[model samples]
Target: MIGYMYILQCSDGSYYTGSTKDLERRLQQHQSGDGANHTKKRQPVTLVYYEKYDRIDTAFYREKQVQGWSRAKKEVLIRGEVDELHRLSECQNDTHWLERYSSAFGCAQASNIIKKERKKDN
Candidate 1:
């Protein structure tokens, strides 16, 4: 089964990150106010980004990683700004492989697609 990590951009301009086995159902719950407390008050969030994982642990860990990020970092993730995301993931000092895992993911691609559509909308 595919587990997923998702990010929601709430009406208040805040972001929520979470992992769930059922992406569609989980999103429904969030929209229906059956989601977490943070989201319940925010009411009416829009799904901005998501990543599917083969393992639940992977999805959970990714959700945590995103949750710990600063708002700008999360925006980079949400916008699918691959170049910026890689820069953010890189080590400030000289160190290889700091962003290896993150860079390998296709998040950048998805982000880019979303970015374009949003541009067309505007």
Candidate 2:
């Protein structure tokens, strides 16, 4: 069966990641507050991103991988900035660049880094 890994932008401006075999039905469930507990509390979520996979397990695995990602990384994926992913994922001492950059300066500074990287790519 086909499967899909998805991301939802919640009413609270937070993100919720999930996987489903039936995207439409699952989205309806979430909208009706019959979804995950997290989505239940943050109803009326908008589907922000998704990836289709050949197997449900593959989609589930991808969901798990994305769930561990920082918001910046997820945003890059959501925006389809595939090139930025490697730049943002650069790690040192087991700490992701975004995590370190964010803690060091701030999200705005991190955004600057992304911009700089984009310029370099171009």
Candidate 3:
């Protein structure tokens, strides 16, 4: 059966991620405060984004994955900005892999190093 992974904007401006086999019914539950506790308290949700999956498990997995994302990351995803999503997915800390790999190559050569790194693993 087809499943849906969806993101909803709550009344207080928070985002809720969830998966359901019947999107319309699930949405109605959320709207009626009969859904997740988070959404129940922050009712009047609006569907902002969703993805369809062939299996319910896949949709549930996607829901779980997106639930851990930062608000900015979620926003970019909702906006359908794939490039921004990848850029934001990278760690910004000093010990980031990019920094470690680029240390020897220098910042100017980081893109080339990144390309090589992608080729090596993926």
Q: What is the C-alpha lDDT of each candidate?
A: 0.84, 0.91, 0.92
Ranking by TM-score: 3, 2, 1
Tens digits of per-residue lDDT for model 1, 1-122: 67899999888989999999999999999999999888999989999999999998999999998899889899988888989988887665312332443366456654565557569979
Mark the regions of model 2 whose C-alpha exceeds 4 Å error after superposition: 94-122
Worst ten in a row by lDDT for model 2: 91-100
| Clash-forming residue pairs, model 2 | none
Which lDDT tens digits does candidate 2 get at residues 1-122?
89999999999989999999999999999999999999999978999999999999999999999999999999999999999998888774323656777888898897688668769979
* Candidate 3: tens digits of C-alpha lDDT, residues 1-122: 99999999999999999999999999999999999999999979999999999999999999999999999999999999999999999886545756876777787587677777679978
lDDT score of residue 27 within candidate 1: 94
Comparing 1 and 3 on TM-score, the stronger one: 3
C-alpha positional error of residue 89 in candidate 2 after TM-score superposition, expressed in Å: 1.1
Candidate 3: count of backbone clashes, pairs at least 3 residues apart or interchain: 0
What residue runs in model 3 are displaced by over 4 Å at the alpha carbon?
97-122
Scored by Cα lDDT, where does model 3 land?
A: 0.92
Show the colliding residue pairs in model 1.
80-111
Candidates arranged by lDDT, highest first: 3, 2, 1
Error of 1 at 31 (Å): 0.7
Each prediction's Cα RMSD? Answer: 12.8, 9.5, 7.6
The count of backbone overlaps in candidate 1 is 1
